[model samples]
Target: MSADLVLDGLDKRFPGSPTPALRGFSLTVAAGTCTAVLGPSGSGKSTLLRVIAGLEEPDAGEVRIDGTDVAGVAAEHRGVGMVFQRSLLFPHLTILDNVAFSDRVSGMNRRAARSRAGEYLEMVQLQGFGDRRVGELSGGQEQRVAIARALAAEPAVLLLDEPFSALDPALRSDMHDLLDSVRQAVSPTIVLVTHDRDEAARASDRIALLEHGVLLHEGTVLDAYRRPQNVRASQIMGGRNAVPGVVRDGSHHSALGAVPVPLDTPTGSGTLVIRQEDVAVLDGGVGPADTGSIAGVVESVRVTGARSEIAVRCGDALLHAEAPPTQRCQLGDRIRLMLPTTAVHIVAD
Candidate 1:
């Protein structure tokens, strides 16, 4: 069965390093849910996962599983399974034996272990590939076998460390679907470490963004994307439009003029953040003096596949917006943009 995982004030530092790998980092993941740990390289993403799996002991803090502290538990005794970016399957062993290695090591008979392995293979949609050697399968299939092997151990929690980062986009998507099916079948508590924002959004119920060994934001995927708490969080989540402004009398005053803000917003210097898709591009006929509208000249237009990225210059601020590919706009064309008050978020500078 699945279990709740909690990291309380975890701190880890390497010798001779100026900064700690993780400092006072804490998060609680509910049972049977997936939480993606997202960060750039050297942001301590792997260190966090290692601490959770009992591979690296924390310098301070508690690692709890189902309300019980496991501070001194050995890696093999921690009831955690991990899959890495590389498959690391034994080349000499058959696919079935690789998956059944853990069970066989635990003293189960070979027949029984292979039988159990077959079941997990079917779960990952590799039912008939058991007889094939590890060298014969494709890269994606090798990763599938790796997953089945980890699952066959039946650990309470599973930790994945960017397992699909090496695969092509199409193959990566297939693995995501396979993970969904596996979750439905066994419901293991999962913590996925990834640097890709879109992967985290697609695979996990919640996202925990980390930077410089510190927790930046932790919430649902939508919350991290739409309701970031600060400028750093906004930038990490791919926010492009950040207009310098000051909050006064329930309005934010900037180059775009005074836009209404939430009544509870404190009056102070802040930055106005809005997602690209939220900025609506309209014809120049729309009056610039309208309540939530501003006039700008198109500075750049880049069509990428199905959507287009538009850059508009209004006064001193350049705002990036997204529009349908069919919505043609040329450089220097005058346009009106509607910045709905609800979509405009004010964040601390």
Candidate 2:
């Protein structure tokens, strides 16, 4: 069965450390859903996971699982299974034995434990390799064994602390697919700690962005990427354009000219934020002036993967835009940019 995990007002500080690892950190992970905790190093992502796993106690606040406070619970009794960044598999045990360790420790007979362990190995697509030693497996396969071991316990809540960070891009993508399959089959409530934005978005339903132990924003993946709450949040989410502007009378006025904003937008100074992908670049033309398109000169162009990243200078503001690699352009080329009013998000400066 899945469990709802909650961290309420958690504050933790290590001895002799100048700053708290987590300060007033709070978030709720719904049953059968995954929430990725995303932040840079020293952002307390790992510390939060440890607190939930009962491996570390918070100096203040509560760690609740399924509505019950588990202040004094031991790590093993918390009904949580954690997969660390490294596989940490025992060298002496076969993959099957390693996965069966949890069940055996719980007093299950050897035969029944191995039987259940086999099921989890199949779930990870390693059914035929259970007899192999840890040294015989690749890094990705070792991580798979680690996941199988964690799941073999039938944990109500699963914690993954950047388990795929060290894998190559292709292998990391494969692990994500495996995770999706695991969620479908068992539906364990999951809390994923990761610094990679793409991984957080691809692996979880929601994102909890942390900064210096502070919960900056907690929302759906799309909202975290497109509707960040502040300048720092925007930057963290990879927002490229943050044009200084003023919101007044349901419109934002800036170097890109006035664009319509939501009616409830406060009338004050703000920053107009738009993702590079949202900005549509067009050829220079003397067409209709009522199209709300602005003219600019291409300052730079760099092709990255399948997209071309472009920088355009319009009046006093330098805007970043993205286009297909086929849309070739050189520096000093005149271009028209269409900044969709719906795509323009006004955030606090």
* Candidate number achieving the greatest lDDT relative to the actual structure: 1
Q: Model 1 off-target regions past 4 Å? A: 262-266, 284-288
lDDT of 2 by residue, 1-349 (tens): 6999988999999999999999999899999999999999989999999999999999999999999999999999889999999999999998999999999998999999999999999999999998999999999999999999999988889999999999999999999999999999999999999999999999999999999989999999999888888877778888889988899878889987887876667889999888999998875442456477888889999999999999999999999999998888789987888888778788866
TM-score of each: 0.96, 0.96
Report the backbone clash tally of model 1: 0
lDDT of 1: 0.92
In the range 1-349, model 1's lDDT, one tens digit per residue, is: 6899999999999999999999999999999999999988999999999999999999999999989899889989888999999999999999999999999999999999999999999999999999999889999999999999999999889999999999999999999999999999999999999999999999999999999999999999998888788778778888898989999988999998888886777789999989998898875444555667888889999999999999999989999999898788889988888887778888877
lDDT of each: 0.92, 0.91
